[model samples]
Target: MSRSGGRWADETIHRIMSMTKPVTGVALMMLHEEGRWRLDDPVARHIPQFADLAVATADGGRAPLARPMLMRDLVTSTAGFSMIVPLHIPLTGLVRSVPVAELYRTLDLQGGSLSRMVERLASAPLAYQPGTDFEYGVTHDLQGHLIEVLSGQTLDDFFAERIFRPLGMADTGFELDAAQRARLSTVYAWGPDGLAPSPPSVTTTDGSRGSYPSAGGGLYSTLDDYLKFARMLADGGRAGGQRLLSPASVRLMTSSLLPAGVRQHFGQRLDGLGYGVGVGVVEDPARATAMDAGYGRGTYYWTGWLGSWWWNDPASDLTVIGVTQQEGAAMAHVGLPQPGADLRALSAALVYGALMQP
Candidate 1:
């Protein structure tokens, strides 16, 4: 089903993009279970640079935070910082008339080490007061850096020693060797004409060259490799008879954690789903069924930038993971229709229909 020229295989590696957020979430919660830090702990406790943050005003002024940003705020995306603004609402008029591609380029060029980037984030004016609303940005990346700070290990190393090794996920990681590079799918993007190959810098995973590990959206994985991770979550954090996370942790990670005020804003982005620790949880089946016929109230899923997607639906005892090289996976990118929005919905509909065909 992948847009890559060859038939999709379980071994093919593709940049899973934001799908990495859930993995980062699991990693942080693992530390949480270890008592390394509490969810409500102020982020300044570990990263002192964020102690005093200013909120950005529409009038081009700055305001103080009503409250400190909490670790849990990052987990639920209520941190008041985001990588993007709505297209119509210009970012201080800086990007009002800029093309999406140019905006992306500006972000790409601002890169530095993860910690350095976080420092830059701390200095920037937040869109709103922390813990007051939902604003999805690089919160997980901050969590990832927090993992390194608290665990005293690189994010990739922490994942390796803990989750991947125990679950038998050999093909998942930030960097890939020659053999893995060979299995990577050819990335394609939709242009005015049709689908065409995308540039390597946009699609390929070059861990050795990137400024920092993008705990937010940087891992490369295969369909089978990610499914193993999904299955672990669905199995109440157990895999192959080993418990990677406590059932309570899994439950908290999968359930909605948004405050009432934030819930409305989150709903605007994802109509029937609620924001969990890292993944999106199905809350209203009747509304979600409009997106995907297979989506049930408890189905949990997330998508990558390049279109790879996975979901664990308890209703049907279904765990589905798909890999594709389409440029706008999840329809998060520009130049596509609303139905072209997240191919995950389409894939789920088709898969569910097949399941019903006795």
Candidate 2:
């Protein structure tokens, strides 16, 4: 598939999925730099809809939260919002399949605004309270909504100005145009049943088209375009001599943000690995499991659901992206062998191998 004017031919368009989180994170950082919002600021400060939130309990009960959710909590996945709930067992399997419009309708029926979603989330209780544990879910999507509220621009527009346009990532967006759509790779899934095609679906509020521009998992991009964005992060948030983020912000975004115990749990195999704002940071190679084979420390990266991956290894001054659209059992079994050849690992291996060649 062509990528932003055919910069890279072998590489194709990637169904970015959750990797969209990092892109959204960058946009939030830009807004923070502009003084539009602060990390500690209450989300309700700008989006008043979130003033009173609640948490869910283990017994399926709910209670009011001691405080409103802070912006940092949403960025860090500590907000306790989940796309799945144990009580809603029947809906678990259909979480992804449920149209975004339907999801919103359910939320609306429950009298849940984005803010109320947080409140109800808090009252329902969390696997862990805000800032207590590391979990990944729809926090970034809330961040996207926060961006909409603060910037008065849609998440798509915010990303276009702060990230895509600056990094020359022309082929990155929540939706593709007709010509680009023709090049979209087919999504595939492997299960106990067998291999099957996984067609793309619109997952936005209203559902007609993706009006909600999900920051959590709503983007399609090509390898070359994504590479530019990765390269900018690798280059300390500057690309083409344009400073998109201050060096300090880049450092902050790529540095360890979690507590020591949380970092250890996530990076147990990697002696010096941790999660930064939106990327995984490798601090020590010796502790990393088999995944650290040829990788260096201080590597920052993230991946998409359909096996797409990208990394910025400051240690090597390199950035790489691998694109594909396969998930589930295919990923567990034939997707990539032994050291696991998923896009993230393969991309890292390719770059590391090339570095060792000379």
Candidate 3:
């Protein structure tokens, strides 16, 4: 899409950050279509390490989990996980020593692998019981691990062969070669001083070749490349004359699955919002009156920490993607209104508004 300042060509690659969750979520659903696993299955079934987990009580003690974390909980963000470091908990020392915490401080941490990340996550207590609340954490990262287990392929290989290659999303993946890196936009953080170049230590953009192929928030892609993925969803899972996912799977991915109580929290983020598989869906039109941006229901979208956003509204056959490398933009929304300052809402307004032409 074009902006006032200059052109954002189809070849420009940007850090998609958390936008990777939906992509990973789609991959998992593909496996589901093959009967490899069910959404309600306990995550421990695939990663036995989570067989016996704990819950972090506010009283400064640990308690046995009320129930196992279901696989659906991971995608829906109802698995009682939070991105917070939880340094005050009983295992502060242990948690700090784990490499996962290093990722919080900076993405430059080396030698840390996704396996150890899962092991560390298992050791930590859940913020709440599975399916009880909405908390975002390393849920999708665990999904990535499960994908590896079931597909017998690294996350990168799985994406390359299954999703990226099939959709012809040539510019989307974890690793970027030198040529790809050259086109990557610089990440900036809005701080006390002003908008300045974010520290290079933020992440290893060299590629997803690192040990941590963070399924939740790690991927790079160009505008046109990601548009293909989004439009595929908008077209009921078909793009380039190929069906990447069945219509039923696409419906399941975009439909509202949030618990009643959690629905309120989702609403708080965006009026009438509901948690779908890996993105937010507009569930209550009345409640969503403020932020619909002329888009109708059945609109599913998600963004990244570095201020990138993408959404597909099947009702209108429209897809919009905005990518910019701006950290600390929407610190409150966890980068939802990517590049901060309400750009996501504005983009929707402009796109849908223009389409209203006679």
Candidate 4:
């Protein structure tokens, strides 16, 4: 068994993968609080490149989109864009090799910008449409791009000033400096092949090579720093006596925004699982049978592409962060013990064990 020897107070940096989504979500909400945008506004209003997007139909053909994508759609993964297609195929890699500045130069949606990526995606068939079904993909990455265009600040800068700086999340951001990199935990994945280190490309965000800071997946943080952010969420967006977001905004971000029957569209029966703006909402704790968390309503959480996971349980005024690194879909099918599930179980056990001690 691989063990992380650090505690929540340790200043070790971790590669946070998709857990970056919640931070990006908070950034958008901060913009919302400032009246920079609204949930219902068409994304095209700011991102003109999406003005001519189309939706892919069942026959593998494209048609004009029925309506413009709303800002909220981007947050909820209902924007008709996806990172993967059926049979586990990736759709586009346009942004994979391009520099960040060059990526934003194209307006035809045929290039690598988030708007362009969505435009190309519009040409591909959607698993579902706007506000119809929930799919996890690059929506939050697009949100990060929107933050850049709308706020006129790079995603990293905006997050640092508005979210990280205020919340005392000192060890969280897109890239790590030398000091932080020295403390970064190595990422590992267990495949049928054997236990191996995750690729430096997959694990490190040193950014010495000028890689585009992917707001969606590009971030490194420490457990304690992240716990600060999570605790702020548990405290309704206040940290260190500073109001990072309004209580209403925090509530709105965590509220279930999916329409009825949307969960079924994913083809998985997540009995009590619902999606909030950017995090997973635990609606029925019992249905999370595969996880070790105490079943409860209103438990909001998310996980990283690596094995990291965190959740905020308001009922207990408690939050937990479990850090590790293992990658691939369906941890059970990956021929190794599922690190995420184990971490969740460990967290739950710790919480319960602490309670029993009292």
Candidate that would win on TM-score: 1
- Compared with the true structure, what per-residue lDDT tens digits does model 4 show for residues 229-260? 99888888888679888899999898776767
**lDDT string, candidate 1, 92-182, tens digits:** 3222213332333345423777777777676666767777766665677788888999999998899999989998889888887877776
Candidate 2 global CA lDDT score? 0.61
Per-residue lDDT tens digits of candidate 3, residues 242-346? Answer: 898999999998988877766524212445778787888887655673455665777788877677888777767777888777763423343222333766666
Q: After superposition, how far is residue 192 of candidate 3 from its true place, in Å?
A: 4.4
- True-vs-predicted CA distance for residue 35, candidate 3, Å: 0.6
Task: List ranges where model 1 is wrong by over 4 Å.
Answer: 1-7, 84-110, 204-209, 264-268, 289-292, 332-342, 356-358
Ranking by TM-score: 1, 3, 4, 2
- TM of each candidate vs. truth: 0.87, 0.77, 0.85, 0.81
Alpha-carbon deviation at 265 in model 2, angstroms:
7.3
Better structure of 1 and 4 per lDDT = 1
Q: Tell me the lDDT of model 4 at 292.
A: 45
**What RMSD does each model have against the real structure?**
4.1, 5.9, 5.1, 5.9
List lDDT for all candidates, in order.
0.73, 0.61, 0.72, 0.66
TM-score of 1: 0.87
Reference-based TM-score, model 4:
0.81
- Backbone clash numbers for all candidates listed: 1, 23, 3, 1
Q: Whose lDDT is greatest here?
A: 1
